[model samples]
Target: MSNFSNVSRRRFVKLAAASSGAVLLKGCLGNPPDTTATTAATVGSAALPAANVGTGETPEVTTIKLGFIPIVESAPLVIAKEKGFFDRYGMTGVEVSKQANWASARDNVVIGSAGGGIDGGQWQMPMPHLITEGIITNGNKVPMYVLAQLNTQGNGIAISGMNRQKGMGLKINDPEYVKGFERNQGRKFKAAHTFPNVNQDFWIRYWFASSGVDPDSDIDLLAVPPAETVQGMRTGTMDAFSTGDPWPYRIVADDIGFMSILTHQMWKFHPEEYLALRADWVDQNPKATKALLKAVMEAQQWCDDPANRQELVQICSGRNYFNVPSEVLTAPYEGKYALGDGKPEVNDFKAGPLYWKDDIGSVSYPYKSHDLWFLTETMRWNFHNGAIQDFDMARNLIDRVNREDLWLEAAKEAGFAAADIPTSTSRGIETFFDGVTFDPENPEAYLASLKIKRA
Candidate 1:
């Protein structure tokens, strides 16, 4: 139904190359090639007994293959499995598949689980929208639904140790400091994100542009796997990288780099990654969709509990999950960071990754306004080359893909307090660290206020 058979010969070739790149990415990360994604649920105990849960309606399907990368954004999925949240909801067969890389995740989602790919799981902003519109799916429109945001404020921009004294913390401070990379160093400021034209890329681009440095022209910004990024930073081949937690902390721990800024400091409570799935699957199994949401929502609340921080860290750091030391995942949970290069240490619990709620409101709710901003930012950078024509088109796409209604249904059914459920789809205006405000109601004004953007 999604027309996978008609992909042009050229686009097919690109997909093949991307598949090869995924294998290369896994090797770069020192992970053995997983011909099939390993099942995360297999490492955890079976579902909780029904007595612990209010037996809601049974789901149409008990199993679904969901994919995730090793990042803080993926904690909810792992927790849902390891903590028996999925089992409590009668969704015992949910498989948390570890993706090789973002590109592989994208390609896998296009194929779907029946074809030996993922149905969907944790995804970066605009990815669900992009996949639905066929902009990034090799021209095959694989409609996706943005179910709920996984977490917020776990992302950071890492500056290689070589530029520790270049005044690159939080803000550029001086445009020439970054612009002089080619003159001072022998090359342009080489930077990368785990994926191109997404949340991580946007964070770094916003930080550079806020200080009057052009992201595209003033630096060489591209996509590189997280492990490759760290290695590049160590060898002085890469100047900076934008990615989610664990890597930012790893950079500091390995003495390869210092965090220029955590995303929490850039835009507090900013929307991060999300849980999405193939729209076809969701459509065919509505009860199962809500069941999945219920499980993840419960897990989010569990993840946010300070008392569960230690167990949460232990579960996420296991070999089947992030595969990093527990300490690498601990500080972000406690909101503690060394923040190398003489910068002051970060020591506030509110600064780390948040799942269920934040200082503002429900982090788990998939706000339509937040989706609009991601689309707007993608358009501002002219990502996908005019695929998103205008704000009106973006709003329409959000209407189709953002399943906030399903999230509300699941929350209410799961016995969430009325205060916890967001009353409105819009979170009002969002303000960034550089004093920029994004009024969701008026995206044109927000775009016009930007000094640097292709739009």
Candidate 2:
């Protein structure tokens, strides 16, 4: 509805084909092959082999469709399927559908699997909150339950090669230099993210506002597909983009762009994406929800294991997944990056995508406080035109959607150590690389301390 559109190249094709009455073909939407089966014979021929291990508690339903974008953040879901973690936990009919892009994923979740879409899967920050309120779904309220966080880190800001001499690395020392794009270049600084008013949007906005540039007024920001973003950069039309790997890594690898900063460097172990599902689906099939959680939890642990990293890449790079060469994922998987344009390389294992745990706490837990931060950031930009009016409303929305209690139950059932389960819902204060601290309890003070904000 907004100028950004949140539409992807695949969605554009879908629209064009529908208008022209052309039959849409497979791979057009990047939709994976259906894995549902009505009989045991057909079940045996699903995409990934199922172990069908006994979990004692049988799920109400064994089939579910979860949509995901082709990024490293979706690795846990892919690994869970490929490694038989879903089957081991009694969820034998899990279908991890490949979405065309973020917009397609959002639209699909709204319709749900029964409507030929998806139940739910990976999401950007506060998307579950937004969807539950019908803020982004064109007034079709779809109650969603935030089950668990998919991952943290594995995201970066990439700048076009044209801006190589602009000193746009981890920190921008001169805001005026960037602000002068219009005066010298004949246009505003153009930037893009996969979706508007979400994780990637907030990350780039934070970087800009922290550097004294008003993201809304000082530049042109829009939601574009990752491929189009790269093309815009290659043609020197787009200035920068914010998205997760391996898109950012591909930019540097293909010699089109250089990394300006990673989300990890911006805020180490920051909340990235999440796992959520239709609340009705979750409520009707409670046991199945926990089963799904356990499967993803085990997959997260497996992804974090260095021994399985290579195999993780291999599975995710298959034709049904990311569809890239193994080499494209290797560097980012090992926490090694080129970071071109004279920036120092990042080679720390903890610097890449961390699913289960990070230095300060568990990455898998969907802390209510992190949800509050995302809502607060949305408020900071006055996103959704005041969909979230104040802190009290934001807190109420979080209380309704966040399902950390279920995560705890699943962890205990899966035999996770007592120490691994979090006792509190909050992860406490979060600090950014710009020396700004966000106290979840005193979000008002956090907003008051900001120099540039619409709130």
How do the predictions measure up, each by TM-score?
Answer: 0.88, 0.88
> lDDT per model, in order?
0.83, 0.83
RMSD of each: 11.4, 12.1
Candidate 1 runs further than 4 Å off: 1-56
Model 2 alpha-carbon miss at residue 234, Å:
0.8
What is the lDDT, from 0 to 100, of the residue 346 in candidate 1?
96
Candidate 2, TM-score vs. the true structure? 0.88
Per-residue lDDT of model 2, residues 1-455, tens digit only: 11111232233334333333212110100111232311121111222222222347889998999999889999999988887777766688999999998889999999889899999999997889999999999989999999999999999999999999788976887788789889989999999998999999999999999989989988999999888999999999998999888887789989998999999999999999999999999999999999999888868876877666888889999999999998889989999989999888999989999888788878898888899899999999999998899988888888788887778667655555444565556788899999999988788889999999999
Candidate 1 has a TM-score of 0.88
Which residue pairs in candidate 1 collide? none
